[model samples]
Target chain A: MILVFCELKDGQIRKPSAEALSEGRRLADASGKKVGALFAGASCAGAAEAAKFGADVILTAEGATLASYSSDAFAQLLADAVKAKGATVLLAAATAVGKDVLPRAAARLGAGYASDVTGLSMADGKLQAVRPVYAGKAFATTTFASAVQTATTRPNVFPAAEKAGAGAVETLAAPAGDFKSVVKEILAKAGGKVDLSEANVIVSGGRGMKDGANFKILEELADALGGVVGASRAAVDAGWGLPHSMQVGQTGKVVSPTLYIACGISGAIQHIAGMSGSKFIVAINKDPEAPIFKLANYGIVGDLFEVVPELTKAAKAMGIGSN
Target chain B: MKILVALKQVPDTETKIKVAADGKSLDPADVKWITSPYDEYALEEAIRLKEGKGAEVVALSVGGDTAKDVLKNALALGADSAVLLKGDGQGDAFAVAQMIAAYAKDKGFDLILCGNKGLGGDNAAMGPMLAELLGIAQANVIVKLELGEGTFKAEREIEGGSEIVEGALPAVITAQKGLNEPRYASLKGIMAAKKKTIEELDAAAVTAGAQVSALALPPERPAGRLLQGDASQQAQALLQALKDEAKVF
Candidate 1:
C-alpha cells in the first residue's frame, strides 16, 4: 500500500496534502497498490475530500492531543500507521509541517528518505525519485535502498484527480494525547482564498517593484490569473511585502506550480530554489541580463509597469483565468 | 545567557557556475566565496539578543580551508569567539549537524541559532536534524522569536499561514529572513576581527552518510516564444501552452 499523510487545519484538507493524495492515487494505479491516507486531528472534512480524490482507506486520529502538530507526536502516529498497514511507500506534502515531522519518522524507522521530489515512479519493485538540487539548477535521480521508501512532493506541481468515491475509514488511538503546547490563536491574513504557496498561477514581485505600493501591479496580474501574489526576499526585506512567511526561496517556502510569473525579480539562486520547478516560467524584467531570463521558458524584456498590465489583459481575454 | 550560532561560506548567488572538468563537483577555480545569506541573519539575531539581554554569542562553522573567510566575517559581525570544524568540505547535512550538535552539547549554551537554510548543497535539513540529534526543542523558519527567562517563543511559517510555538531554554531555532535585520560590519569591528580567536578542530569523526555523486548544469531552457496580448490574450496563449506544448497545468 502507498500511504499519504493528509495534513489538515481547521477541519479542511490543506490543498498541498490533497495534491499529494492525488499523486499517491496515480502511483497506486501505476504499481497496482492500495491507497491509504493518515490524518491526525478532530476534523473529518478533509477525509471525505480525500475519498473523492481516490483514497481507498482513511486512518484518522481525533484526540485533543493530536489537535495541534508536535513533531514527536505526529511522527509517532504516522510511524504506527505506516507499520499497521504494511505500506511499501509513504508520501507527504513538502510543506512546513511535513518537513518538520517526516525526517524524525524516517529516523525512527531507520529508513532513508528523499525530499522535495518532483516526480516518482515504481521501477522494478523499487521506488525511483527525481528531485532538484542546487536550487533547481540540477535534477538528481535517486532510488531508495531501504525496504520502505518515503518522499515529499512539492505542491501544485501535481494536479489533484477528481475520481469520486467514499473510501473506508478507521480511527486510531492518538499518540501522546496531551501536548506540551497548544495553538492559542492563529492570526492568518483574513482573505485566505489565494495563498501564494498553493496558487496554480503565481505572480511575484521583487526589489525591482520598488516599494510596497508597487505590489499592486503584481496583484493585478495575480487577479487575472485567479492566483496569489508572491515576492522575493529582497522585496520582503524591504517591507514591500509581508515577512518571511510569504517569501518564496531557500529560506522561505518551496512552491511548484503550473505557471510562475516573475516580475522585475532578478532571479537569485535562493529564489530559484523555491520555484524553479514551476512548469512554465515567464520572466519580465527591464534588465535583459537578469539571471531569471536564463531559466525562463518565456522571456519579456520590458518594464513590468508596461508589460504586466498588458499581459494581465491578454490573460483575461484568453479566458484561461485561475479557478 | 549564551548562544551558539552555526555559519557557513558559499559561492555568491550571482557567481557564474561552472562544473569541474572531472564532473565530480563545482569548479572551485576563480569562484568567490562569501558568508551564506541566511547565516548573516543568525549572527545578527544572536548579537542583538546578547546586546539586549546581557548574553554572549559564540559562532561555529564547518568547512574546508575556504571556510576561514566566513569565520572571520562572523567575528566582524559581533560573535565573541569562533570555532571551525575543519574538514574536506564534503560534509552532508547529517554529518555537519552531528558535529555541531556534539560540540554544542559540551558548551552548556542557553540557546542555539542557525540559518533556516544555506545555499551550499542547498538542503534545509541541518537545523531540524541538529535539533533531533541534540535532543533539544526546535522551531524552524522563524519569522519572530522572543527570548525570556528560560523559555523561547517563536512563529514558524506553514503553507497557508503561520504557527506559534514555544519551547524552554537551551532550545534551537533557525533564523528566517524577517526574524531580524542584519547589520553591516563596522570599520572598528573589521579591524578587531583580525585579533579574534578562532580555534580549528579536526572533524574526521563527522560522518556524512550520503555523498554527491556528480554535478551538472540543468538542461538548457528551450528558446522563449514571447506571448503577446492583453491579459485575456496572454491567458489564452498560456492555456494553449499548457494543453498543447507544456502539458503541465
Candidate 2:
C-alpha cells in the first residue's frame, strides 16, 4: 500500500495535497495496491474530500496536540501511519509544511526521500523520481535506497484526476511527547489572495513597475485573467508588493504556472531560475533589448504602462475571466 | 551561548549550469563555487548573535580540502572556530545531515543554524532533518528571529503570509532571505582567518540515501517571437495568439 500525507488549510485539503493524492492513486493503480490518505489534525472533517481522487483509506492521526503542525509530532504521525498501514511507499506535496515534515519523518524512519520531484514511476516494483537540481537548471533521476520509498511531488507539474474510492476514515493515536516547537500565531495576508505557488496564471512585474502603487495595474490585469500578481526581486526589494511573498526569482518562490505574463521584468538569470518551468511565457517591456524576451514565448516590445492597460481592456472585452 | 552554523558550497548563481561528461552529475570544471546564498544569512545571523551576546560561533561543513575555503571564509566573517567533516560531500539531504548531526549530537551547543536550503540541490530539508535526528525543535525559512531566554520567537514564511513560532532552547533555526545582510570579510579579519586553524574530523562512512541514475537539462524553449505593431495592435494580437495560437487561456 501507498500512504499519502494530506496537508490542510481551513479544514479543507489543499490543491497540492489533492494533486499528491491523485498521484498516489495513479501509483496505486499501477501497482494494484491500496491508497491511504493520512490526515494529521485534531479532526478529520475533510477526509471525505479525498474520495474523488481515489483514496481507498483515510487515516487520521487525531488528538488535541495534532491541532496544528509540529515537526516531531507530525513526522512521527507520518512514520507511524506508514508502519500501521504496511505501506511500502509514502508521498506528499512539497509545500513548506510538506518539505518540513516529510524529511524529518524520513529521518526517523530511515527511509530514502526525494524532495519536490516532478516525475514518478514504478521501476521493478520500486518508486523512482526525477527532480530538478541547481534550481531547475538540471534534472536528476533519483532512486530510493531504503525499504520505504518516500518522495514529495512538485506543485503545478502533475495533472490532478478524479476517481471514486471508499475514503474510509480510520483514527490513529497521535504521538504524545513534549513538542518543543509551537506556532504562537498566524498573520494572514490581507485580501487572502491566491498563493503564487498554486496559481494557474501569474502576471508578474519587475523594476519596470516604477512605483509600488503602480502594481494596481498588474492587479487589475491579473484579476481580469483570473490569476495572481507577482513581482521580481527588484520590485520586492523596492517594497512594490507584500514584502517578499510576491517575489518570483531564485531567492524567492519557484513557480510553474500554465500562463505567465512578465511585464517590465528585465529577466535576470536569477529571476528566470524561479519561473523557467512555466509552460508559456509572455514578456512585455519597453526596452527591446531586455533579456526577458529571450525566454518568452511571445514578446511585446512596448511601454508596459501603455501595453498592460490595453491587455486588461482586451481581456475584459473577450470575457476571459468573467466566470 | 554556543552556536553551530552549517553551510555548503555551490555554483555561483550566475554560472550557466552544464552537465558533465557523466550523464548523472554536474561538471565541476569551470564552475565558480561560492557558499550557498542562504548559508551566508545563517552565518551572518550567528555572527550577530555572538557579537551581541558574546557567544561562541563555530562554522561546520561536509566536504574535502577544497571545502575548507568555506570554513576560512566563515572564520573571516567572525566565527570563533571551524570544523570540516571529511567526506566526498555527495548524496541527498540525508547524507549531508547525517554527518553533521552525528558530529554535533553531543556537542552541547545551545543553538544550531543553517540555510533554509542550499542553491545546489534546493531541497530545503537538512535543517528539519537535523533537528529530528538530534531530537530538537526547528523553525525553518525564518526571515525574522529573536533569541529569548531559553526560548525563541521567529517569523517564518508560509504560502501567502508569515507565521510566528516560539520554540525552546537547543533548537535549529534555518535562515531565509531578509534575515540579515551577510558582511564582507575585512582585511584585518582576513589576516586573522589566515592564522586560525580549521579543525578537520573524519565523518563516519554511510551509504547514500538516494541514487542518481541520470542528469539532463530541460528541453529548450523555442525562440521567442517578437510581436509586431504598436501597443494596441500588439494587445489585440496577443489576445488572439493566447486564444488561438498558444491556447493558454
Candidate 3:
C-alpha cells in the first residue's frame, strides 16, 4: 500500500495535498497497490477532499494533542501509521510542516527519503523520484534502497487530478508520544497578505526600488491587482520590505505564481531561480538591459516610478481582485 | 557552549551551469565555488552566540579538498576551528547527515547550526535528519533566535506567518537568510585563519541509503518576447497580452 499524508490548513485541504494525493494515486496504480491517506489534526472536516483526488482510505487522527503541530508528535503518529498500514511508499507535499516532519518520520522508520521532489514514477517495482538540485539548475533521479521509501513533492509543479474513490474515513487513536519542542504561538501576517508560495499573482521589488519608502508604490500595485508583494534578496538585504517572510528568491521562498511582476528588480540568477516557474512574467525597469527583461514575457524599459502607478491605475480600472 | 555549524560549498549563484560529457554531472571547469550563502548566516549566528556567551564555534563540512576552502573561510569569519569530512561530494543527504551525526555524537556540544538548505543539492534534509539521528530537538528555517541556559527560543518562517518554537539544549537549528548579517573577514582574522588547521575525516565511516541514478538539466524556457514602444504603450500592451495571450489576469 502507498500512503499519502494529506495536509490541512484553516480547516481545509491545501492545494499541495491534493497534488500529492493525485501523484500518490498514479504511483499506486502503476504498482498495483491501494492508496491510503493520513490526516492528523483536531478536525478532519476536509478529509473527504482527499477522496476527490483519489485517496482510497482516509485515516483521520483527531485529538487534543493533534490540535496543533508538533514535529515529534506528528513524526511518531506517521511512523505508527506507516507500520500499521504496511505502506511501502509514502508521499507528502513539501510544505513547511512536511519538510519538518517527514525527515524525522523517515528516521523513525529507517526509510530512505527525498524532499521537494517534482516527479514520481515506478521503475522495476521500485519507487523513483526526480528532484531539483542546485536550486532548480539541475535535476537528479533518486531511488531509495530501503524497504519503505518516502518523498515529498514540491507544490505547483504537479497537477492535482480529481478522481472518484471509495472515500472511506477511519478514525485512529492519536499515537502516544513525548514532545520536547512545541510551537508556542503563531504570529500571522498582519493584513491577510497572501503567502508568496501560494499566491497566484506576485509583484516583487528589488534594490532598484531605491529604498524602503518606494516599496509602498509596489504595494499599491499589488493591492490594485489583488496580488501579494515580494522582495528580492537585494531588497530584503537592504531592508526594503518584510525581511523575514516577503522575500522571494533561491535563499527565500520558491514561488510558482500564475503571474509575476518584477518592478525595478534586476534579474539576479538566484532570484530568477525562485520565480522562473511562474506562468507569465512582466518586468518593468529603467535599465533596458536588466536581465529581468530576458525572462519577462512583457518588458517595459522605463522608469518604474512612473510606469508602476500607471499600471496600477490601469489594473484598478480593469477591477482585478482576487481572481 | 560549544556550537557546531554545518557548512557547504556551492557554485557561485551567477555561475551558468553546464552538464558534463557524462550527462550525469556538472562540468566543473568554469564553475566558481564559494561557501553556500545561507551557511554564512549560520556562521554569523554562531559567531554572535560566541560573542554573547563565551562559546567555541567549530565549522564542519562534508566534501573533498575544495570543501576545505569553505571551512577556511569560516575560520576567517571567526569560527575557532574547522573539520572536513572527506568525500567525493556525491553522497546523498542521508549519508552526509549520518556522518556528521556520528562525528557530533560524542562531542558535548550544546548547539548545532546549518543552512536551512544547501544550494548545491537544494536538500533541506541534513539538519533535521541529523537531529533525529542524535535524538534531539530541531528547528528549521529559523529567521530569529535567542539562546538561554540549556534551552533556546526560535521564530521560524512559515508560509503565511512565523511560528515561535522552543527547544531544549543540544538542539539543531537551521539558519534562514535574514537570521543575521554575516560579517566580513578582516586582515587580522584572515591571518589567524591561515594559521588554523582543519581536521579531516574519511567518508568511508558512513554509508549512503539513497543513490542518484541519473541527472539532467530541466528544459530551458522559451525566450520571452519583448514588447516595443514607450512605457505607457508597453503598459497598455502588457494588459492586452495578459488578457488575450497569457490569459492570466
Candidate 4:
C-alpha cells in the first residue's frame, strides 16, 4: 500500500493536501497498491473530506495533542500509520507544514525520503523520482528501493484530482509520542485572496519596483489577472514585502505555474533560481539590459510604470480582472 | 550565557552558477565562496546576545577545506572561536546535524543558532533536523529573539503567518531574513579573522538516505510577444488572444 499524508488545518481540508491525495492515488494505481490517507488532528472532520478525493482508507490520529502540528508527534503518528497499513510508499505535500514534519517522520521510520519531487515513476516495483538540488540549479534522478519510499510533491505541480464521494474513514488509536514544544500564539497578516504557491498566474515585482508604495501597480495587475503578487528577495529584504510567503529563489519556494509575469525585475541569478520553471514568462522592465528579458517568453522593453497600468486596464476591460 | 552559531560557505549570491560536468551539481571551481547570508544573521544575533549579557559565542561549520572560510567570517563578525568539520563529500542534514550535535554535546553551550536554510543545496533541512537529533526545542526563521532568565522567547515566521514561541535555555534557533541586519567586517576584525585559529575536524556520514544523481539548469523560458500599439489596440489584441488563442483570461 501507498500512503499520502493528507495535511489539514483548522478542521478543514487544505488544497495542497487534496493535491497530495490525488498524487497518492496516481502512485497507488501505478504500484497496484491501496492508497491509505493519514491525517493527524484532534477531529476527523477533514479526514472524511479526503475520501471524496480518491482516498481508499483514511487513517485518523485523533487526540487532544494532535490538534496542532508538532514535528515529533506528527512524525510518530504518520510513521505508525505507515507501519500499520504496510504501506511501501508515502507521499506528502511540500508545503511549509509538510516540509517541517516529514523529514522527522522519515527519520523515525529510518526510510529514505525524496523531497520536492517534480517527477515520479515506478518500475519493477521500485520508485524513481526526479528531484532538484543545488537550489534549483540541477536535477537528480534518485531511486528509493526500501520496502517503503517517501516523497513530497511541490504544490500546484500536480493539480488536485477530485471525485464525487468521500472515501471510507477508519478511526485510529491515539498516536504514541509526547511533544514538548507548543505554538503559543499565531499572528497572520491581513486578508488576501491568492495563495502564493497555488496561483496559476503570478505577477511579481523586484527591487526595481523602487518602493513599497509602487507595489500598488503590481497589485493592480495581479488583481486584474486574478493572480497573486510575489516579490523578489531584494524587495522582501528591503522591507517592501512579507518574508514568509514571498517566493524568492534557489533557497526559497520553487513554483512551476502556467504564467509568471515579472515587472521591473532585473533577474538576479538567486532570484531566477526559483521561478524559472513557469510555462510562460513575461518581463516588463524599462531597463533593456535587465537579465529577466533573457528568460521572458514575452519581453516588453518599456517602463513598468506605464506597462503595468496599461496591462491592468486592458485585463479589466477584457473581463479578466477581479470579480 | 554561551551561544554556538553554525555556518556554511556557499557561492557568492551574485555568481552566475554553472552546472558541474556531472550535471547533478554546480561547478565549484570558479565559484568564489562567501559565508551563507542567513548564517550571518545568526552570528550577528549571537554576538548581540553575547555583548549584551556577556556571553561566549563560538562559530561552527561542516564542509570541505574551503568551509573554514565561513568560520573566519564568523570570527571577524565577533565569535569568540571557530570549529570546522572539513569534508567535501555531501551528507544529508541528519549526518551534518549529528556531526555538529556530537561536537555540541560537550561544549556546554546555552543556545545554538543557524540560518533557516542555506542557499547551496536549498533543502532548509539541517537546523530543524539537528534540533530533533539533540532533543532540543527549536524555532526557525526567527524574526526576534529575547533571552530571559531561564527561557528564550522568539518570533518565527510560518507560512503566511508568524508564531511566538517560548523555550528554555540550550534551545536551537534558526535566524530568518529579518532577525537582524548583519554587520559588515571591520578592518580590525578582518585582520583578526586572518589570525583566528579554526579548529578543523573530519566530517562523518550520518545516514545513507537521499543522494543527488545529476544537476541541470532549468529549461529556458520562451520569448514573450508584446502587444504593440496604443492602449485600446493592446487591450483588443490581448483580449482577442485570450478569447481565441491563449484561452486564459
Candidate topping lDDT = 2
Interface RMSD of 2: 1.4
- Tell me the whole-model lDDT of each prediction, alpha carbons only: 0.75, 0.88, 0.85, 0.75
Worst 10 residues of 3 chain A by lDDT: A238-247
- Cα TM-score per model: 0.86, 0.97, 0.94, 0.91
State the lDDT of candidate 2 residue by residue for B1-249, as single tens digits.
Answer: 999999898888877888888888888888888899899999999999988888999999899888899999999989999999998565678878888989998889989999999886887888888898898999999999999899989998888788898889899999999899899999999999999999999987665677788989988899988888888889989988988888877
Q: Backbone clashes in each candidate structure, one number apiece? A: 16, 0, 0, 14
Fnat for model 1?
0.31
Q: Who is ahead in DockQ, 1 or 4?
A: 4
Cα error, residue B247 of model 4, in Å, equals 3.3
lDDT score for candidate 3 against the true structure: 0.85
CAPRI rating of model 2: medium
Give per-residue CA lDDT, model 1, range A81-162, as digits (tens). Answer: 8899998888898887887776656544545566767788888766777776656766656566567777778777777777
Candidate 3 structure quality by residue, lDDT tens digits, B216-244: 87776767776667666777778878988
Model 1 C-alpha lDDT versus the unseen true structure: 0.75
Q: After superposition, how far is residue A203 of candidate 1 from its true place, in Å?
A: 1.7
lDDT of 4 by residue, B1-249 (tens): 889999877787667668777766678777888877888889999999888889899998988777877888788888989988776424455557768877887778889999877766665667766776677777767889988886877887766667787666668888877788888889899898888798888765565556556566666555657766664565456556655665555
Q: Which residue segments of model 4 deviate by more than 4 Å? A: A144-148, A163-166, A175-178, A237-247, A251-253, B89-91, B239-244
Angstrom error of the Cα, residue B232, model 4: value is 3.9
On residues A207-313, what C-alpha lDDT tens digit does candidate 3 reach at each position? 88889888899899889888889998888887555565777877778888889999889989888878887888899888888989888888888888988887887
Ranking by TM-score: 2, 3, 4, 1
User: What DockQ values do the models have?
Assistant: 0.35, 0.78, 0.64, 0.48
Better of 2 and 3 by lDDT: 2
